[model samples]
Target chain A: MTRLTRHDARRILDGRDRSGRLGALLDAAAASARPAELGGEDDVLTAFRAAPRHAVRPSRRFLARFVVVKAVIAVALLGGVALAASSSLTPGGEGSPGQPVAEGGRADPAPNTPTEPVETPTAPTPSPSDTSIKPFKGEDGEDPPEPGRPSGKRLKQLCRLFLDDPRGARAEKDYPGLEERAGSLERVRRFCERLLGEGGDDGDGKGEDPQDTNPSPKPSASHEDTSGPGGPHNGPQGHKGLSARSDGTYVG
Target chain B: MRPPPPETDTELSACVDAARSGDEDAFRALFRAVQPRLLRYLRVLVGADAEDVASETWLQIARDLRGFKGDFDGFRGWAATIGRHRALDHVRHQRRRPAAPVPDEDLTDLEAPSDTAAMAVDALSTDAALTLIASLPQDQAEAVLLRVVMGLDARSAGKVLGKRPGAVRTAAHRGLRRLAARLGPDADARPTDPMIPAGALTPRDAT
Candidate 1:
């Protein structure tokens, strides 16, 4: 038997083989049509009918836009949360400076009580102290001689002394200047009691100064007290008396 | 033959264009021309599952037709490519080699005529011829089937097999030589056998 050449094979594959046997073999292979070969034609046509004319693949632009939108929303949400957190934290820190002062007052009562009385005695004897206390007295005093508008400094001093030794300070000999400026011993005690109560309860003493003036409408009594203390005492006396009356009105 | 004369390239190109435009009859014509060839090619790769694989192949072809761009020859190559992919997928899924070629004993039962005159007159049965071709090594078997049985040129067959045209042609030549040797001396001796009419030996329409 002769060997099949590349030429012969090409011819046979091209269906030009006249050499008979291999051509017949290829013919038979091609001719053999099983029913199953075309059986699914209907199914294929059905699939074709259901297919979209131009199926949509997710384009690059659409995907990029979607990602950008998501990123924007995420950044906006984070920024809003950060802004809210900073705004909330700032006021909370600034608004409560009073807490630390109140805590300090409670924590060092021993030192504050002793220092306050000594400071008060030294303060009233000095002319320099009187000049310094005058501006504060003027700013705080609304009535000329009413006891409702005392300077904060003087009221706090009297409160400390009265609270320390109310009976001792009430005696005319021990603090003659203080008793005279306060109008009477009983009034000094009452004024000191109100100052301590309001200061302790309010915790923020700096914030309570304006509020203390609302109740000091007893100018007639303060005028009488100022006239009795005489000229040298009038300025300081009027200042202290007005403050005491103011504190009284506030307490009342 | 169930299919009419093998469609000329222009006819197939027209059918593809019509099918893309939703012409049902044109799509049916395209299926008729391509399915049998796809089935026979797949059979060499996937055995009994060729039918299922071919069905999958056709479904893909139908759906993706709108995106296709080529002449009829290109369409054939495209369909064959889809079939080859689906066949390999089936083989991997099943985790087995192409079902062993019809056993030697089964081939013996077909009693393929040894005489060139008898072969020319009666022809080997389609199943028997395919079994004989399948007996060749896989590369040669696929080369012969794609080139001869599927009516693809060497370049198109090479595209389907992922080989160069030269390699596919060589494989096909070797396969035919082997098939000739198997058919024995008489079949090989008569290169110009007078008994076989030229018309009778022309490539049969697959569909």
Candidate 2:
């Protein structure tokens, strides 16, 4: 069967659905359904107040939760910002500080004091000082020769170059073309051997040379490993300051 | 099927919005506007225990109003749905009980039958009308109450009744017809032209 319309129901409720006798019946039916004030408005108010807070609306508890969420997001954002800033400030941390020193064994070296004068390469017969070994095989503006294990001959050349031209060692960090094997055990051994004068070269006026010329108190701060006079002396302090600055910036 | 309630007053809508946000004063206004009819609807459906069902219904309404997603008419329909559920629960609870409701407790609030004849307005007694409505099947009685008393449209009433709009409409028509029949031929003043056609009022005829 087709249904009664809501309009019809409203008509019945309002006593307007039917007219004449039917209207009277609708009116009579609706009148009996009139809301007898169950109680006063105060009762309703009391009931409304009595309802649990969560049921009522978004209460203060929700506001408190939202505040907590906002606080967490803010702290996370600040942390991200701090990390970004500190990373930019200190590019090299502990991981990269010991980077330039390629070979671990060559960390200790004799002081950078050239026995031979650089101006005169024309030593008679070059018998006393061996000029046969050249540490830097490459000429100016050319790539150096390929590096290999330092032999006795290669160490003599490395020690001679480390003292006379320490820039060559510094340049290896910037351009590791061929002098990549610049620091090796054999090279370190040869350097020490040269300090002791393995041959009779110490007898030919080498006795006047200062025997103990190691630069810094720390063995790690090798004179040949540093570029300038200040490079060896202030290198450790500079490294410490960088690390401390990164820490302070990270926490701040 | 149900056209929305015609109470589109800006102030009442604003009050509903405020009530949804847990504004006590706005809810108070809302309660005042809809309570009377809601109570009456409950009365028709649950008889003497209507007030108790109504309180339960209000508790649910207050709890769920925050999530309610409609204007004033939607609010009314929503409330009627809750009230219907409460009434059913009360009915179910009553059915399980071995003892019938005590007559004294049932008759306590209303005036005694002797006094009602003298004091009842328009000589149309609530007790008499409720008795007539209660005689109809549960679906028909609730349909009539929700549609007529609560001012819910067919669709909304159907939603509350858990019936299709067509079904709710049919129930209401049958209910009114049954009431007219019980009241007798004399009650139907217009006999020749029936308000509800024999087949029932379809959506087409409702227009």
Candidate 3:
């Protein structure tokens, strides 16, 4: 049936007071629902006075909570300062008042000793160990390189960079042609290796370096895989996995 | 001036006048006379937690009772305004509470027997219906209940709900639509005439 129109609504409401079923019901309800204890306004007042102060003086409780929070913050600040100062005073901090001599290590001077300030040569940095081992060749039957592991600060810096600008880290390879964008060869090489070494054949893998666009070989596919980073449909093309909004565009 | 006792309408007005003149008993009597209806109104407008709200409403009335200068109806309207505010406060409080399953057994008893029976005669007495009505977005439900059940006209209901008369009518319409939907097909069979038709002489029709 078509929903009750407003006129019908008005009718139902009006008919409730008649002697018919609905009307009788309404009458009974109205009669029975006479709110009692209506004269006990003083009792309600007495209860109001007896009830919790927190309900009555909310601002006071709020102030108390604020004071407690401030006191805790003050204690925490004092404790942190004390801990930091004590730790800095402990034995193994930076270089002592006087101690050692190594190229990249600390220099030392003893008490009462007139030491000549020597100009230490800022040495040429040692080159990183070659990581030229190719990601396992398909025919060799070796597993794809485990990209999850990396050495020293490289891993930390990579993690920090990825965490900070995840999008840029993924698209690092697409950047070389852009004028202001520059990346170190080692960093680029590492990014490329990480991209290529991930085992999944899907081109949609995230945390991938945009420079290496090669489609990995599927375990089920025996055909020779030809798609690589510089291939026509490969590099910096068709990245996926970002969220799409209602407007039919990818969101951050 | 000595405060008048607020047992009757004249007493209530005199009590208010005396309280205005700094008579504490007059103020206390005024509070006693109005507190019950205000509490019941709050309890219905809000929920069971209206005890606290009722308390707060009275405290406000005690503080502001002298400010009201009118006949008994005006005093009632003033107290009603305070009660409505307390009810709103309770509503806001309920919203802030985390959602949890309302146990079926928890709803075993409700205080509105007469109301339930009234609804039952029309076969509209389901607990769910009451809850659904109560749970409707506040503006709509308040307008509908104040106007329909309490017999307040749109203008008076609007004043109690702090909305314009047009807004109150709209809210009541929307609220009834929602309530009809909740009622399912049964609401179709109900009579279709205004409960209180315009220009009705009898108090029953008037309400």
> Model-by-model lDDT, in order?
0.53, 0.46, 0.38
Supply every candidate's count of residue pairs whose N, Cα or C atoms clash at under 3 angstroms. Answer: 12, 4, 14
Off by over 4 Å in 3: A1-42, A45-252, B1-41, B91-132, B177-207
Q: Write the per-residue lDDT of candidate 3 for residues A1-252, one digit (tens) a residue.
A: 245555554554443323333332233222222222343455545533433231222343345455556545544544454455456765442342222221121121221112111111011111212110111011112112233335334443443344333323423332222101112211332343353345332222333433333433223222111112211211222111100110011000
What's the true lDDT of residue A93 in model 3?
Answer: 29
Descending-DockQ candidate ranking: 1, 2, 3
Task: Please report, as a residue range, the 10-residue window in candidate 2 chain B with the lowest summed lDDT.
Answer: B198-207
Q: What is the lDDT of residue A31 in candidate 3?
A: 28
B68-115 per-residue lDDT for model 3 (tens digits): 345444455456655654444334223323242222232222233444
Fnat values, one per model, are 0.31, 0.13, 0.05
Models 1 onward score TM values of 0.48, 0.48, 0.36
DockQ of each: 0.11, 0.05, 0.04
For residue A48, model 1's alpha carbon misses the true position, in angstroms, by 1.2
